[model samples]
Target: MNSKMLQRQLKKLNLNPEEGPVNKKEWQDLIKLIDVTYNEYENHLYRSHNTLNVATDELQRLYTELEAKSSQKIQVLDSKLQNIMSMAPCIIMWLDNQGYIEGCNDYFRQLLNFNESLDNKKITLSDLDLHTLQVRAEEFIKSNLQQTSFTKQIANYYFKMTLNKMVGQNKISILGFDVTEDFNKQNTINQIQAKAVQSSKLAVLGELAAGVAHEINNPLMILTSVAFVVQKHIEQNKFDQLPEKLEKIQSTITRISRIVNGLRTYARDGENDPMMPVNIADVILESLELCVESIRYQNIEITFDNQMTIPAIVSCRDTQISQVILNLISNAKDAVLPLKEKWIKVILRQVEKNVVLEVMDSGSGISLDIREQIFQPFFTTKDVGNGTGLGLSISNEIIKTHYGRLFVDHNHPNTCFTIELPLA
Candidate 1:
């Protein structure tokens, strides 16, 4: 007898239960074939289920390994970031929207002289001892600027600070680099350069001493003649000519006063002078007053060509600029004094947004080999005792400080040094 489930399946397959099999042999063969098919189907189903379970287990194992690796990589990156922040040579700080200290790196803490960690400390900008930084930070916060930079002095150290506002966040970051050494070094260099410039001025004065003496002597002779004439008039009781003679005397004295004043102004230290907008033409004229007499005494014809229709106004230290002009004029005089045709011409003009001043002499242009080195400190073509070689170098430096350019105009027909300064 077959099982009840198999008998029902066989009945459904059109084998009637009430009527037995027509052929007993064929009926048994059909039962055997059905049993074989059912077994194959059950084995296939079990293999598919087992494969699915194994695949699920593999997927879980891969996911766990990926997570572990990701976690380890994150830890490594975090450690590196921490080390970089701690070892950096600059001050780094973060602040909340309300200007309260949020966090800072080790350098920042050390800069502020903090003895304890600021992890949970509640501190405001004003609560710190940095008054200037606090004030500037407040100003920056109040401004619409997203970032700004400035220099501040704290105790004995100087710092160039940069402040930035984080985008899409109510936070500010402050970065600072210690610049005390650089600042002090620059100041010392400026001082030395100032002295060198002053010394150069004095040297020029020494060269002009003879011409200055002659210049003053002429006016002195006129004064003396006028005084003698006035004395004669007083003795003769002729008061009418006295007024005219007195006017002449006054004019002569004024000329002498101007020469002396020019010398005094040129000899002073102008290193710390504030920059002001001045007419370049006026600077040239004033600079000429100090050396014009000297040039004329050497029979060197000097002329000024002011081509600008308007004032060539430039922002600069006029005194320092005067020194540059004087240095150039002195150089021009030396260059042409030995030549038969001696002449110096100063041309002032405006080019685009710049004021250009050219000091040209009646001589062949400088050779290319030496032109490149003319602006180097302690490089000169003059006799050993005749030149300090710092004039051109100092002049170039001064022009640079004024945000201008000084160079040799090799294209010109004559030897010329050009100064190009931005218009004020």
Candidate 2:
């Protein structure tokens, strides 16, 4: 409680050094106030110094943590970008303005079969060692410098290359995409379609087999008769009449050849044949020749109604279209065979921009429940062992390929198959 002691404490506490005289009691009270003030100042100084030390330590730790995290983030981003460049299924390269390879990804290295690092080799369009790339390098460089994109095929492999000019730099980013698998797949699909077309032709031939035999048989009988008459004329010494009989024999042989030729055409493979303007009426008549015999044998009255005398021309594959008409006529023959009053009528006419041919049979009409499904593959109303069910389906596809239509006339009095071909 002494003033001297209080002054010493105040000096230690860095407080003001001035003091005043007073009574003993007052002095004691002042001494107590100075001690309390000194104690508070000392505690505040201790706390401030301790707080600064703790803050400094924490800031150092935060700085170290921030440095570590920033480095790690940068490393991860770099790795991700490198992986993207390497894993891309394309040739990515940066070329200088002089058409020299500046940089390229792993894909480019692997594609061009570069065993060593790119730095070891001076790769340029002028001297690319790869055979395939060398052949196209000059052309590719020309197109790239012109800022044009193009597609090229090397052997069975195809590529689509794009070039982009780098802004603020004398460089171009070239991207070569491999489209070989897609191209090969498309070629495979085309082959399959071609086979399907051939199968359709064979199916048509199978349906007309019996009728074709009967057609050829009738001509054979006429030729035999003409041969016997010519022999009789020669034996009777009828020289004047020999010319007429010889003429008959020639005409009969010609008829037989005509029938055989028609059958041979229908049976030929026409999948690769080019489209041409065909006489629609002549094709119909030819189809009838192959089918009329069998139709007559089934006790079906077969009639051909031609509303157009001049040949109705349509743009189509001649033999394929004939197969379509033959298929329809064969189907009509089979359909009318089961009916008590059996008849198959053929009508040809030109309506608007289309030439229409209709084959109508006096048989039970197609049911409404199955009408929509009739053109579907393997759908038939006939017995299973007797029908392959592909006749109508193949015919429909052929007509569609010709840019025409083959459909049942639902409003007709009988089961009628109508074909509308575009007129040429």
Candidate 3:
């Protein structure tokens, strides 16, 4: 039905557009129009619904395609990263929080002597333990996890490692760099320094050799006189006093033997000398014996005051300790030789848990500015060609190695160098 026909029928039936129809023709036409309109609206709605369905299907297909591409890209990136880690020269590995080995790179596998066939295998920290390679894997992990980055020495090799905390995972990435060659080179330098210090000691002993020979001469003369007296006693048949003379000669010989032994020990060079309990007083006395001849010749009077009757024992290398004392005494002699009244005083005493030895000299005390620099290597106040300037420096190092201290005493009127060693 058309709009004109529907309007005329409604008007003839006296029906308002807003109210119900009265005429039968009006009602029939209205009903027909309603049916036709309903059919057209339904057709339009069905077309719109079909369009929406097509759009929804296309969107779902595009989302699935994008998701697949993203997963592929992620896999490729992961493969590239794994290849880079494998090709790296230094050791790299991923470890779980519980010290389990999650994955390791090629360098790390080679370091542990593992083949590439075990690349997919799950290896843990405990699997690395062996009798030949004593690795405390738990401690290693603990140290690294605690520090985040540190250097570790396993067997003879040194490795510097850095740790990275993983996101959303209970694991750490460990990156290692080998440093054994550099470490060995540093060790070689230290050995050379030790040898140089030993050589310096031998040079000082050479300078005192003449004085030592003179010291030996006095005992030789005493023995000669005692031999003559013994011969005279035998000729006169005076056996009662003969034993006394012989005892005196024996004592002199013993004294000479001790001096020679001390020199021999001081001159010997080796790395096998183990630390032991040493008598500080005896070390001082022996040192004095080595320097006495040179000191007396230079008009320097040296005195040793050991107050304790019992030995002041300390844990140290005996000869190295003696070397330090001799070096101090030699330096004192050089310092006070120009003074009018020259004297070197050595005092040995116990202070609490320490054994202290002070070597005091009459020279003008070291200046305030230079005292701090005196222990520095190659620092010297002596004229050119007179000193190597390493004696005090080496002595300081030796004392430090023994867990002792060598320092200058400023309270004394004279130049006093004090050495304090822990009591044994």
Q: Per-residue lDDT for 1-424 in model 2, tens only?
A: 3446666654545233465333466556567877777887788899999999999999999999999999999999989988999999887887765666777789877765655556746667445444454434445445645465767663345888777777778677778899888878988987976666567667657766787787778777877887888788789987787788778778877867777788877878786789888888877777677777777877889999999756799888878888888878777777777679988889998888888889888976788899999898778877867666777887898899899999989898789999998888
Error of 3 at 55 (Å): 17
1 against 3, candidate with superior lDDT: 1
lDDT of 1 by residue, 194-276 (tens): 77888888887898788788888899999999999999999999999888999999999988987787677678777788999
lDDT by residue for model 3 over 1-424, one digit each (tens)?
4556656655666556677657776678778876776777788899999999999999999999999999999999999989999898887877776666777788877777766454556666456643221233445445635335566764457887677777677677777789889878988998988887887798688778888988889899999999999999999998999889989999999889878988987887634689888887887787777779777877889899887656798888888888898889888988887889899999998888888889999976789989789999889888898787889999999899889999998887889999999988
Better of 1 and 3 by TM-score: 1
Return the TM-score for candidate 2, rounded to 2 decimals.
0.64
Candidate 3 colliding pairs: none
What C-alpha lDDT, on a 0 to 100 scale, does residue 392 get in candidate 2? 83
lDDT scores in order: 0.86, 0.77, 0.81
Ranking by lDDT: 1, 3, 2
Per-prediction TM-score to the true structure, in the order listed: 0.74, 0.64, 0.73
Off by over 4 Å in 2: 1-82, 90-204
> Model 1, stretches more than 4 Å misplaced?
1-90, 105-111, 116-122, 138-150, 162-169, 350-354
